[model samples]
Target chain A: MTAATADRVVAEARVCVAAVLDPELPMITIEDLGILRDVQVHDGRVQVTITPTYAGCPAMDAIRADIEEAVHRALPDHGVDVLTVLAPAWSTDDLTDAGRTKLAEAGIAPPGVSRLAGAGTSTTSRAAVALELSIRCPQCGSPDTRELSRFGSTACKALWVCRACSEPFDSFKNH
Target chain B: MRSTCEAVATEAEYAVALADDALVASQRLVEWVARAPQIEEDVAIGNIALDLLGQARLLYQYAGSLTDPPRTEDDLAYFRDERAFRNVCLVERENGDFAVTMVRLLVLAAYQRELYDRLARSVDPTLAAIAAKAVKEVAYHRDHARQWVLRLGDGTPESHRRTQTALEAEWPWVSELFDGGWLAPALVERGVAVAPASLEEPVLAFLREVLDEATLAEPDPRPAVTAGREGRHTEALGHLLTELQHLARSHPGASW
Candidate 1:
């Protein structure tokens, strides 16, 4: 493949991998979790960078294997390498707005931007900070939820019990 | 021993020391997978356990790579006799309750956080690099444990009582972590290891903050009885190892 073709193929492979659902949270893709970082194609090999959900998350190995398989299947003749990076810690804040919306829609409440939302900014042009600090319940659309545990299923989410509905649910906590 | 490069023993010992703690604790933590009080906590602890396991793999692999005898991580983790294993006995203890487990985690993670932070700047390049990466994970571990200690200690009368008892029970083991045997001092002399004693104040301060938040009092410090690094593990590790290595031992060369 040519250089330009390889780059396009690499980008396409990333999008394909992004469609792969997380085993724990089937609603969100690994990419939606912001675990996928960079993709590059060199020679006949395609290198992909993914930050782990947590330090020792078992899902990472599975995710890597899945990525490699998916990429290889997508680009038959190219080799794929999945690189795990641990420098900058993974945070729920890295979730894209669309990802958050997907999570909220799936009934797993996404984290609210407490620091950003409470900054008292009125002009909403993607200001780095806004006043949307309360995590609304995906089930009940209420902000009256209490944090039960800092850790949730798979170590990437936190346990939050909603007060309005009296139902316990998981919230993807910020790192 | 040779002068400069002759420091092999210290490097190997340091790696074993950290790896032992990680390996044993990880074994214990993985037990809580489906048995946790809640699914969220189950995954959380499992994740932490997994992190420690990773560290163990790296440290043990690094140690194996360095030593001429060439022992793999599995060899050091499973095949070694008790006397050859250098992990602290405290880490090998059973997970009593959520409170007990959290207390142990709080103390160990806090200590490890400081240890890794200092080791991140070690003269040994490998140790420094591993520590730098590990520091981030350990920080999260410390936070997870800290948050639990607070919640359990201050939650209710029952939770407070349980968490306090757990804290006191685990306090005796804290001393052993700060005083390493011959290996620790050697590494310290070479500027490759942080003295466990220097970590005491910061660790204590962090613990105090958590305890205070939990509405719990700091337990009086007692002189710890040492044995872990010298290979004197609790009876728990033997059982733990038996369970962990069962499949691997039973099905030799069995890959599923």
Candidate 2:
């Protein structure tokens, strides 16, 4: 294949792979979740690098498989490789505005702004510095919601209940 | 002549030691999945266990890469015998009660929070990266345990009594956590690993804060079962490992 054709193939592969939805959070694509790191065509091999949002996220294998299937649809003859990395761990700050919108529309609140201040902000600091911070209820748009549990159905969410609407929902746990 | 294992602990050894601690605690916590008092509790406990398991996998993979011939994380986790395991004794203990489990979770997660935070800046890049990721995840675990301790300690007469009893039951193992002697001194000096002893003050202070808020008194500071770091463990570890390694051993690369 010519250089231009290879470039076109890589771009098309990126589009297909990026559209692959996360297994657990089916509302958003991997690219929207910011887990899709890079896609490149090197020496006739297509390489895709992605990172996990949480260390033990059980959805990673499913994601890898999805990406493979997606890429194969675009370039059946090309070798596709998926590599998972750990450095620069994922944060809620990585979520795109579109992802946030999708999460809210789906009744799961997106991560709040404060959750983005990674590492230096400990729970102790959060309790003291950011008291009264509330997660907007996606169901009724109520600012009055209480956390039911620090963890939810998966590794990346917290269970919360709305005081106003009495609707229980999951909020993306800001890590 | 001394065996290579008898000499100074390599970075891989240190990684495996921590990994074993995570893996064992994870295995034990999995027992509470369907048995937790509430459905939320079940997911909460399971999530914590999974986070630890993830940390263990990362550490073991890093450890394997550093070894001469290299071992996969599974090889290190399943192929090793009980005597060869290097985790501390605290994690392998059976789940006595809800309080006992929470107390153990609180103490271990606190130590992990401290260890991973410091290890995030280690001289070794791979270890540093893993630690950086882990420190964030473990902070949530510590918080979960803390919240539970607060509830159990202050909830009701029966809960208060049970929680205090659990704290005491788990206290002896806390001493073993700060004993840094088993780790190679060079690792500490080179910033690859922190002296476990250095974590004592911070961990204790955090525990004390939680206890004070919850109206729970501190347990006796006496030491017990302090040799798991050196590979001498209570009978509990063997039993724990048997269950953990059973599927891997029996299936021998079998996948669904």
Every model's TM-score: 0.78, 0.95
**Model 2: what TM-score?**
0.95
Least accurate 10 contiguous residues by lDDT in model 1 chain B: B1-10
Angstrom error at residue A25, model 1? 3.5
Clashes of each: 6, 0
Candidate 2 C-alpha lDDT tens digits along B44-162: 99998999999899899989999889899889999999888889899999887899999999999888888887888899988888888888888788778888999999999999999
For this target, which candidate reaches the highest DockQ against the unseen true structure?
2
Off by over 4 Å in 1: A1-20, A112-133, B1-9, B30-48, B61-72, B95-99, B120-168, B184-192, B211-221
Give per-residue CA lDDT, model 1, range B41-93, as digits (tens).
77788878978998887789889888888878777776777777788878989
* lDDT of model 1, residue B180: 51
User: What TM-score would chain B receive for each of the candidates shown?
Assistant: 0.93, 0.96
Q: Is the docking of candidate 1 incorrect, acceptable, medium or high quality?
A: acceptable
Off by over 4 Å in 2: A1-3, A116-132, B1-5
* lDDT (Cα atoms) of all candidates against the true structure: 0.76, 0.86
What are the RMSDs of all candidates, in order? 6.3, 2.3
